[model samples]
Target: MGDYTDKVKTKMEDLIENEKNQWIDLALKIHENPELSFEEHKATQWLTEPLEQAGFRVKRHLLPELPTSFFAEWTGTKAGPTIAFIAEYDALAELGHACGHNIIGTSAVSAAVSLKKALDDDLPGKLVVIGTPAEEEGGGKILLVENGWFDDIDAVMMFHPRDKTMIFRGSLACVDVDITFMGKAAHAAANPDQGISALDAMLHSFLAIKQLLPSLPASANVHGIIRKGGDATNIIPDHCEASFLMRAKTREELHSIKRRVYDAVRHSTKAIGASCTMEEGLIYAERINNRVLGYQLMYNLERIGVEVDSSEITTGIGSSDIGNVSQLVPTIHPYIKIGNAITHTPAFTEATKSPEGMAGLIQAAKALALTAFDLFQSPSLIMQAKEELRQTINQRRNRL
Candidate 1:
């Protein structure tokens, strides 16, 4: 640690404490007025307001395809690495802020501001606050990466509110598949032989998927919902639609499992005399938790009196768009413990507004600032992270 370490950390704490209320208000306000994925206009405005005011050059709606997405950046002092704090503000359907993105987005903004305020002209590198929306459904960060948004970033960090805090927890690679079946429509009583039943084809596909499930690896998941069954009870359905999500520890595993699942759907549709069309979303790759970068966050969180989860890591964690970002560069998606409730629940929504949630937000902000400070202070940290990512890629390649 450098001599300025303590000074920088103290500055972060002081600045965060000084403006704690304003950040808390931001989180609570977002929680009160939740916005769904790809529809976070108000959230974009609220989240970018402080960053723009802090002398950061703000760019709104960076993805014209996603009007809610934005990013703010600041470069200070000497040339060095560019570190980003990812912000997710999209809410869940009906559940509203049950996922605690309100806290995630505001804490990121507060952390960037604290770092800028503390370092001022002494700041060693570029600072960025990336406004990523639609995490709940559309995979906004995934789209951003596709458009070269993360090309210049050195290290990316974000803290999620969870029941347990893990520094290097993993996530699955996942994809959404929509399957549609088409068949001839006819009056059931008058022309039973003239109809090809789309419902029957869909049911056959479901059965085939169920049969294929046991053949899949234990790490993989295949689940789906039937979106459209039939329009009328007496008529042979002309069309049917269903959606399924496939997940595995990594993209390699997901690819194999996805192939089998789709094969089953195709063969099933053919057996039932129906044609099918399938639409697949972007693949959210498994999270590569850069061990080197994770340590910075773990140390900072521990220093702040938060018990970091150091257990032998468990698999089967849910997927995130951050997982997609992780594949591109060194990243850390640390979890901050807020309450006992798991995410995507009414209780979790309440926790996001509770005192405990506010405390977690402050601690998370400080951790983010301190970790960024450590990275800027030591260029070798970035090298180590990049090397770790390189090794991970080689290992994954060999496995594949």
Candidate 2:
């Protein structure tokens, strides 16, 4: 395989290296001007500029609901499998680029662009770069999948910038919920007996969740904060709102957790003579990393001198919209080490544009490009990937 594929790998590496400065600058520019989810206008513009220049038929705001979302593709003359590089460019609210998504988006477009440059018109497959926004707040990829954006794509590839480079890190299935309680208000001291305190209902709900925690499965997690408690201490609170996120290792477990937790919240509100209303965010399914493609990517990463820690791959993980994408198609969301600083911190934000982060960016680009080439170069590999994905989906459906 080395003798057969060394030429393609060399060309991929060369293409990435030749345009390293441009890609690195793109990452830096995005890091310098951070945007929140669903609002990545500048980041989207900067990332897609090079793709359009490289002759990709870029489609901006592909999803009507998400104006920042985009789909860019460069089709070869010959018909072949469609391989997509998913790009995420959303930043944390206050911490800016703490999650290192700047690198994720940059590396994806860099890979797609590099592959276009290296393979040119002789490329056997169709290449696409999806400018997916809002991995941090909204589930942009989830929306895309629901709207039939990935229906035609055969396989998808992308890497995340993290503290440790893991080959097959998994993400928990998660959902965000907002609970509101309504009650009657009165002066605290003057007419305490006449008021029904919404704050008390909210407090009871929190206690109910904490007390129920020990009984839940080890993988279950419920964390939240009081978004609105009261306007003034002198009056009995008439309205309150709290937001919470629930997570589990799989979507099945998540359903059970949500049922029990929501029941507890409802009973608590009823006990307090308060009416409750709840709203939920998109459900981020547990990630299913395609092993056949994962190993193929591991080969490329190794060839580039980047050591992949396969053992700790499942260790530290949160939720992301990519989890939804994995459920639909063969996907891999590997992580590359930039620094010891964990994600969503000021330290992590600084490390995004650090020299180490840039190094990860370049290696990720080459590996992604090479992996895409590996699939396009051989029909057997694509068959194996599609088969694995089919079996995984069937198994999941059986579980359901």
Candidate 3:
């Protein structure tokens, strides 16, 4: 079994290598045409084009609201585990693919295509590639999970390009709060006393939250930006809006933080004789990296001659929609080292199309394909992974 697995892995790697140029071109093209979240129509079309040509059955716009999202599947001759690859293609506003999503989306496509070619008609299980959009701002995966898109998948996997290569990392559970304050508007020179300044209330809220942060836990934090401050300095502002993103180690902790911050906003607005309302986005749950699958990925990564770094991510964590998907199925969002520059920056944007970036992309594709091959060849691994996910979920529920 080990020998056959090795041969299959070799074939998969060869397939990726032989067509590395084409894959590189695709990644570069995606980098050139950067699209924002939920508006990745071109990216969706480009990503699925190769899959459809390779004989995978394609479905576009799984959800009416999420029109850019899609699903492509290939069924085997026999019944087995269904493994799905999650693809993210949304770019940041103004930064234009600075987050390396171009690398991410293309790597998933290359991996799935190579794996299918290596196995051919001998595949024993189902393979699917899910195109998930709006990850940067909107919770695209959260919507898909709620709609039952991932209900039948046995395992899910995706790769992220980072400064370091790690298999297991923790992410914060997060939610965005949009706060709006309303007050009476009046001319500053004519009757300043008659006007209630909404900007004052917004500023007070920021101060109040800053004061509250010291009392909160180290793992919890709140960052905010003023979406609408005022129209002009000569006139008293009538309306103001501030957006805050609160994050914590877990959703429970995040909830507590939100309550405190909401209280602060209310009190601050009331003190300034203004009324305020808060709107929140979907809650992004903390990540639960399936140890069973993560270890398999680590092994395969090393087999491809890429050195494995520490498997545990203890600090410097952020939130992602993948965290929501990890809650349902055995999932791994492993990171491959692209360069020293971090994500969401101009330097990182350049690295996504650089030679080093291309190397990381190919490495990521090979590792993903090989690890997926492991799941198809060894069903016990899938069972163990699912059991691990069950235990983790139960433990989280007990804590709550």
Candidate 4:
């Protein structure tokens, strides 16, 4: 926007450009060896090695409970805001980096290093790259937020690789439920009267859920798979289990849907002479984008010759652990266009390692670094973003 901002942004561009190949190589290494959620030991090591080597204070296994999660901090000479870039490296099961998380994780680290290098360590705030694993299966960032990992962060930023480029896309609130049904087992023909079939109870629950979905809001959904319907058709099943992933527009709506679904499950279990237990994983809150930060990122992307689609998306939304982090602090999870391939697909996996994907990675790193520079240069921006977050939280509470 001004001479000083332009000068600093130029430095960042040069720094990130000079080492683009290294970042791409790092991302490709992670993509080649995909790791599942909470089991990203190699990805974690590869992502953090550069930070550790760059003189940043790197902490491995940040929380003992989360083995793959780590934190790297670079503080300036003067006191100011703490801007954090979130890195999600966990790949989908069997899909292997279809979501382009290798790009997300690498871009965060590259941005932090370039920003620090561009400033020559004479900046006015702290730069942090948080290695948050398990966005695929487990809510690693949600757990980190619960454990006070994001308590002092003034702002959070991350870029996702998608078919489209968007700055203010919203995500649904979600949670996973593990349903277990227990009943007495007996031979199908030999002791038919003595058998209490858990499989029947599970089937009844599924039917009830299917019937209930039609009555619920279009934004609310309950889908699941029967993990163990029965060991054999000849025997009455004593134990059965199912896993369902539920989603809603907001946490309040999600809670209501959960209540109805759980009621149906219990009612179905009772009708079939079986007992059931429902274990819920972490509840991922809906994302609340800070307009102030979002605008800064959008402006940075535009300045760097990257196009950002600022349109509103009301449907085809998926949930993320970043949603939970957004509830706690001001956060931005914008998307950078890598290719026209849908995520979580084999085509998307190939796109993550494509030349276009590498270009997107460099663009993401520069935008993130530039945005952080702007915040450090102007303390008032941090205050404005935080105020917006406060208002957003209050509005959500009032709605609930």
Candidate 5:
């Protein structure tokens, strides 16, 4: 390795040793005080305090609509590329960090801070730590990218805690929709013929969706919940609310399946003499990974004694807001193992606070820090990442 590379590796090792306890403490604190999507006030405060103290100019982007999402930037003297370290801190509803976002938030903060310190003198670029909220619901990063937050960013990095470590595993395209059914209400025993039950409409819609399953592709998924049914047993329901999530491998495929779903909802409600309304919610695009950056990160992880299995790299059905960011910039959202627990469950919560969890955080921080150093030190890698991203986006647009 070159002298500059050696220096960065040395500094990363020292930073990991010095900030290990601090990171663990922060992770545990965030885990203990879990906050839901778009309400991560405590998490935002916890992450930004350290950045401000480290002499970085912190700016809060408060949208009149979205209060919890924000971005912080730290610039170095030498002019080069801007690298963003994305952090997510939203907890699942009632699950309380079951997805291990506490580790994600702390690991990102640790990586950004270590990178900042490593390049404090004679640095070549800028370091940005972006606190993204509501990955569980709102897709906050999608809004940020839409508003041009990532316009100048060259590369983005973040790690999620999973059962194993691997390179870029592509994610599915997803759309969340809220469906409401309205009908006339009357006494079930006295005027049953005069009542149009909204619950009956919902049942028809569910049955239609069940039949659609056989026609859907292997990559397609449809899931939903009936949020509201009725008030009492003797009264015909006047209104019913249901929410659904649709997923597919590509946006085109997602759109195709979504049309069938909408038709199902419309026909079912029409047959029951009930009107229906559909409201769009979070829509996540599929992740487009930068292969050049993926290989570079894999190399850095191996240098740090993290063995990543190639056979483990596969497409994931779950979606993320990071997918939105990847569409705009070159990005990598690699997963590092905490333990063998299934994510989004109580067992995952326990594993996230374990000793193994702390170790995984440190390892991820080191790998991310090293990868950032490589981007700053080696211009070729950064150029290749950008070029790959440009080509991928162009190809996708052409297909569209």
Candidate 6:
């Protein structure tokens, strides 16, 4: 077993060195050309082209309904334990790869490619690379999972870029909603009393939420924007729309908070004599990290000289599509730090493309590939992971 582990390590090291330039170039290309969620045509092509060229049978699952979203798979000759690597290529709106999705695409692809190269000699499992889209808004992984995309996979793994490297305990709750208020439009000056202002309803909703903040838990968050307001200045606007994102520590807590939010909106609109309509957008559950798999990743990372402090286990609150994936299967989404800059900002964008970012990319690829290798090689670890997931599912069912 030790000999086999060493062989895999040697193979990964060699593959990293050999494919360094290719991976870096891929990252830069994706970074240079950013595409928004479900609109990543060029980015998807760039990601899958290299894999297709490397003799992997590339299959695309196109939802004609969803043009920008796709699924790519590569099956190995021998199938023991199916290991999956997930890739995200969709960038933020107008920000390009500011969230460092280019690095994410590159790192996942590199891990899959490296694993493929290692398994060429004696294949023990099937390697699947799934291209998930619209992680920023639509919870693309949740959609894919609901469509039965991750049924047979034994385990799922993906790494994200952050300001530090650590195994996170869990993620926060996320809920997206769209609210619209409808009122009668009339002349603002001549018939001010005859018109009901939708803008006033929105303002009242905001104020009501602000007043409710003291009642909300520390972990809960309520933030939003008025996407649409009155069009004309002299006339009262008939319709106004707003979007909100509410987050909390648990799914139940988020639901509770959502109910209050709905009541607030309803009452606010009612106070202004306007009708209100609310539509639920996307609801992402908190991530429950598989502790056994997370520890295995930490072990593999340590073997590769990546020092992750135990104190770094508890990270900040953020939501991800991978959180949705975690509920369906045993998964790990470890964050690897490239620099001290926070994500979703210009500084993060600049740091993500810098030399330090490239180096972190390689290190992240190495860690992910090695972790996959460990899962492939150790049946005990695989059983441990499966058992952990089974217990979690059972516990949730029992509580229900």
Which is the winner by lDDT between candidate 2 and candidate 6? Answer: 2
* C-alpha RMSD (angstroms) for model 5: 2.0
Superposed on all Cα atoms, model 1 deviates from the true structure by an RMSD in Å of 1.3
Q: What tens-digit string does per-residue lDDT give for candidate 5 at 102-200?
A: 988888888888888777755688888888888887888888888888889999999899898877788888998999999999999999999999999
Computed on alpha carbons, the lDDT of every model, listed in order, comes to 0.91, 0.91, 0.93, 0.92, 0.87, 0.82
The CA-based lDDT of model 5 is what?
0.87
Candidate 5: segments with Cα more than 4 A from true spot: 397-400
User: Which candidate number has the best TM-score?
Assistant: 1
* Candidate 2 local lDDT, residue 198: 97
TM-score of each: 0.97, 0.94, 0.94, 0.96, 0.93, 0.91
For candidate 1, the 10 contiguous residues with the lowest summed lDDT are 309-318
In the range 1-400, model 2's lDDT, one tens digit per residue, is 7675778679889989988999999999999999999899999899889999999999999877799998999999888899999999999888999999999999999999888888779778799999899888888999999999999998999999988888788889999999999999999999999999999999999999999999998999999999999999999999999999999988889999999999999999999899899999899999999898899999889989998887535546788889999988889989999989988899999899999999999999999999999988886887898899899888877987
198-224 in candidate 4: lDDT tens per residue? 999999999999999988878998999
lDDT of 5 at 285: 89
Worst 10 residues of 2 by lDDT: 309-318
| TM-score preference between candidates 5 and 6, better one | 5
Q: Which residue pairs clash in candidate 4?
A: none
Per-residue error (Å), model 5, residue 252: 2.5
lDDT for model 2, please. 0.91
Which parts of model 6 are misplaced by more than 4 Å? Answer: 232-234, 311-315, 393-400
The residue ranges of model 4 lying beyond 4 angstroms of the native Cα positions read none
Name model 2 segments beyond 4 Å from true: 2-4
Candidate 6: tens digits of C-alpha lDDT, residues 67-102? 655555566566678888788888877666778888
Clashing pairs in 3: none
